[model samples]
Target: MKGLLFDLLFYAILIFACIYVLPNYVIQRTIVDGSSMADTLMDGENLYVEKLSYRFDRLDRYDIIVFYPYGRDNTEYYVKRIIGMPGETIQIIGSDIYINGEVLEEHYGKEPIADPGRAAKPITLGDDEYFVMGDNRNISKDSRDKYVGNVSRENIGGKVIFRVTPLNRFGPID
Candidate 1:
């Protein structure tokens, strides 16, 4: 009878651990489904999103982040990179990103591609808004797309620190 009681207690503890502790402490698994992050993140790659770092530090340029957009429903989330920050003017001209009237030299993309002319007009981000773009400029529907404009700080979920799937392709995201 005592053995059975101990076994029940152990099972209860295990169940509690899975239900509460795991979700709070462990990484959440997600899969990249679109070509938006191409050349940097491939389609169908499994990823472990890190939720701990952003809570302690400020996000930086080139950081790959995940954010919930303003519309199109609550179930979907968008992933992109931080390009233009608050109080900066962002413009896309001839496939290059210009911040505050200066050309940004670093390129994560393999080749130069024309802007879709979707958001050809220059946009100045609000103090709490961030401008994001996909590395795969040609294929990605990102900040350049009218539908997904500057992302507000409130909608940002977290920054992605690494990729954990596809076995051989797993590593830190640039």
Candidate 2:
């Protein structure tokens, strides 16, 4: 009876971690805070963020990521898509995004950017910097804004893998 009780207790702890702790730490969930990523990730939708990937893999262009606006300890967070990679020149002219003088071909931007803001002029990213922007350019406060600026590698928390809520759209994110 003693041996059986010990085994049951161990299994229970393992099950608890697999169901709760692992998902909370290794792969956390975040709710879309705003319409910044409209059409791509809707506001209030639940999405899974893979924390392990950021530690082992490198970030690529167009990958949706979540980060703290001020720092990792801050409560306010923002989700945006990578636009300009490390050491690349980024600029926006007449609602079009140009990377190193070449116009980027992407269908993610929901509408033509009306206000270029700080990115209206050419800005070069550092080796450790990445420029990000929201799909809904019109109202997004992203890298284009002076305060948001370019995101460093450490500031990025994780990649948003997929939407888990709103049953109809449950699947991997594009």
Candidate 3:
């Protein structure tokens, strides 16, 4: 009876560890801390990032993503939208984004940003690089900042698949 009880306890612990810990290896949780994605995503909102989404498919424009800021802590991550794709030349003039010399049509910003800094320059992305920016251009610390430059494809952690917190706002992230 003693041996049987011990075996049962061991298996119970193993089961608990597998069910709880294993999922974390594939999925992660994050909270929006700033106004970078304002109007699109609010601050303090809880989100689920799918770490495995990009392995099989190429990331698309306007796909909100989480990636590490270059040269920053590996565990530190930032969320932004893909504005420029591989091999594309991107330029920001006033409130408009010019891609390959054509103006991009996006309706997420509330107002046209006047000062986009160096991100305003026409930059041609590399084969494995992506240009990102925050929906709240006036307040987000994004690719326009020299410190948080273009993110490498490998640095992209995952896609913001859903928002799970603030019960009223729970739904698939657009």
lDDT of 1: 0.78
Off by over 4 Å in 2: 5-9, 12-16, 19-24
Q: What is each predicted model's overall lDDT from 0 to 1? A: 0.78, 0.91, 0.85
**Clash pairs (backbone) in predicted model 1:** none
Instruction: Check candidate 3 and list the clashing pairs.
Output: none
TM-score of each: 0.82, 0.90, 0.86
The true-versus-predicted C-alpha distance at residue 158 of model 1, in Å, is 1.3
Regions more than 4 Å wrong, model 1: 1-26, 71-73, 116-118
Model 2 weakest lDDT span, ten residues long: 50-59
Candidate 3 lDDT by residue in tens digits, 76-145: 8898999889999888887888899999998876568867777678888899889898888888888778
- Writing each residue's lDDT as its tens digit, candidate 2 over 90-141 gives 9999989999999999999999999988889999999988999999989999
Model 3: residues with Cα > 4 Å off, grouped in runs: 1-24, 71-73
